[model samples]
Target: MLAEGPLEEAVEGLDVEIEWKPFELRAEPKATLRPEDPYLPEIWKRAVYPMARRLGVDITLPTVSPQPYTRLAFEGWQFAVEHGLGDAYNHRMFRAFFQESLDLGRLDVLVGLAEEIGLDGPAYRKALEDGTYYERHQDALRDAEAHRVQAVPTILVGDTRLEGVPSTAQLRKAVLDERARLAASVTVEGVVCRADGTGCA
Candidate 1:
């Protein structure tokens, strides 16, 4: 939620393409955290709230107990990507979780969110039931593992990795540096006798 807004601002008008990859902190079989747990509230008060305030973002630690496993949500993301609604789906997912406290783990809730984003509700529900995007989601997870992504908000600019929550200034600088690196690496070949030859260089 926090990273999305700053990321948009950072890449505005820049020759950059942003891809939001999936990384599950607690993928299946593993127990998820509960908002009622002391650890959650403590971390929120100590770090999350402070960071949100610094970034001028209104965020809250959700009250959902045994937080919903996100595999279903990510699978829905795969469906959204195929339908050209990836960005909208991502934003809505964040809002539904943090602001609206919607259960992303529920099929009905996910289908409703998909409909809200202009996707065919029944088609999406059927896809989820049939596990249409299950493998695709798994592929994305493997890609994240290959990249050694161990945390959320792992922003990569060129080969540089920015972990955790990053300020807009930090993102902008990384983008500019990456652009400069790409520009420097591009080599142009000079043509000889270009004026006399129809085919040259």
Candidate 2:
């Protein structure tokens, strides 16, 4: 989604509500990833590589994986999302971890990132330390568990869940299909759009 902003552009004209829920992958927060997953090579080659190329992300496999906990970043993103930083922090974090290999598990690092995005650095640090937004992170985890989201980039479009990094075209099509489905369920007026996102779509 970060690559080229395709998802954002795809839905710009749809008037659809987009909700971002950030959470860690494991069953618990602040869990560490193993040094190696044997299938990482295949996934890197099959999915991540091609998607990065197609999206022009310039994404690279980390030379030295930080294996950092994303919980702090997810909690800190509450401020970013509220402040309208426009994904700057997310992009910065992505670059830090993937390209520059910065450790995300540090408070000072995250605070600096917040400051870079024009957010209140000290205040964000205070809030993070006070656990003010931990509940929100927990809520996100609960929602993720409820959705059975076992993959990264799981997007919920109506009743359908598109897991992993889905193509921009597929994301747009899902939005249209879900919109049509919801419109058809209306009692007073039933407006059915084409399934291909063509007319009335």
lDDT: which candidate is best? 1
Write one digit per residue (lDDT tens) for candidate 1, span 1-201.
888878989999887899999889998899999998889999989998998888888788887778999998999999999999999999999989998888898899999999998999999999889999999999999999988999998988889899998878889999998887665553337533333344354
lDDT of 2: 0.75
Candidate 1 has which clashing residue pairs, if any? none
Per-model TM values vs. the true structure: 0.91, 0.80
Per-residue CA lDDT of model 2 for 1-201, tens digit only, reads 443366786697878877767758754444555436556567778888888887777776654443777788888987687778737877787887777766787899889888987899998899899988889888988888898877777888888788776777888998998888876553324554544554452
lDDT of 1 at 123: 92
TM-score of candidate 2 against the unseen true structure: 0.80
- The segments of candidate 1 whose C-alpha lies over 4 angstroms from its true place after superposition are 187-201
